[model samples]
Target: MSDFGRKGLGDQLKEKAQPDSTKSTLDQTKESASGLYDRAAGAVQPDQNKSATQQLGDSTRSTKDDASNQGQGILASAQETIGNAAQAVSDTLQGKK
Candidate 1:
């Protein structure tokens, strides 16, 4: 009947329509954490032998250092690829006629 009464009813309807907003946010957070874990796992390959802290022969230690450097290089390459893709998209949008 009154404007205030109608406004209260509208607010109640909105609340009832979306009761799982908090659950959706928690699910998104879990999904993001899972993705981060997977990425970190992929970055570190499985080493059959001891870690870098363990003492090893010169050749073996050098090989390990090279592998570590290679991993960093790969990360740089992936970053560059992502940057190039973003730049391409930006250029395409700006070049639109």
Candidate 2:
């Protein structure tokens, strides 16, 4: 066989022995995309560390605390009003006119 023909066969064999560059790059791209998707899923994941019932319990506790504070404020205001009314009644009864 001519040296040129032998060289051509050798080159063809080398090419076949090597993986296709385009297919290799495409596989890498697929793996990168899969990794990105996994990270995004993890980032957007709700506090999986906490259950729904636990979160609800915390919210309920906060709301109860808020209501308790509001009730205390109202009670304070009512007591003040009553004290003022009592003072005014006592002053009127003493007839300081």
Candidate 3:
């Protein structure tokens, strides 16, 4: 099971947590391009007017977007949990909790 191109959970979480300001220029450009393409596609072909194959493509894209969003949410929750644990430990050490 080579995971070559796929990001590991830690990497994914780190990426999700990274501030937009710190993203590479290339990454930002790519995101902008993707957004533009999506907007153009939507304007050109509203959902109800798509062919069967186009509808399938749209569905696949939607599913992928949904999964990515869910992954980011999970990562945020994990980061919050870890931060809270760390804070609790610090407070205990300082006799504040």
Candidate 4:
């Protein structure tokens, strides 16, 4: 082969061998851009909204506890009435009159 042709062929081979360098640079640029996007996303805050939501959750829990206690009291009262009725029936049957 002639010298110029050999030189041209070598240059083509060098370019082919170094193709990954371009891809590496592109990947690094994508990483930097993604890092910037993450930082921007992190900068956003929901401070007041979060606090309000927590307060609402606390209020709901308190209300549920109150309702549960009220229901328990009602059940206890019904049980007491049943017990009294059973005692009266037993007294009448055993000739307590």
Best by TM-score: 3
Q: Model 3, range 37-71, lDDT digits (tens) per residue?
A: 65367446666776555566556657878999999
Candidate 4 total steric clashes: 0
State candidate 3's TM-score: 0.59
Task: Kindly give the number of clashing pairs for every candidate.
Answer: 0, 0, 0, 0
Which candidate should be chosen as best, given lDDT against the real structure?
3
Worst 10 residues of 2 by lDDT: 1-10
What lDDT is obtained when candidate 2 is compared to the true structure?
0.55
Per-residue lDDT of 1-97 in model 2, one digit per residue for the tens?
Answer: 1121122333334444666664577765765565455334433445454345434433454586699999999999999999999988998999853
Provide the clash count, candidate 2. 0
Cα lDDT listed for each candidate: 0.51, 0.55, 0.65, 0.53
List the candidate numbers ranked by lDDT, top first.
3, 2, 4, 1
lDDT, candidate 3, equals 0.65
| Cα RMSD of predicted structure 3 | 11.4
Residue pairs clashing, model 1: none
**Global CA lDDT of candidate 1, please?**
0.51
What would the TM-scores of all predictions be? 0.37, 0.45, 0.59, 0.47
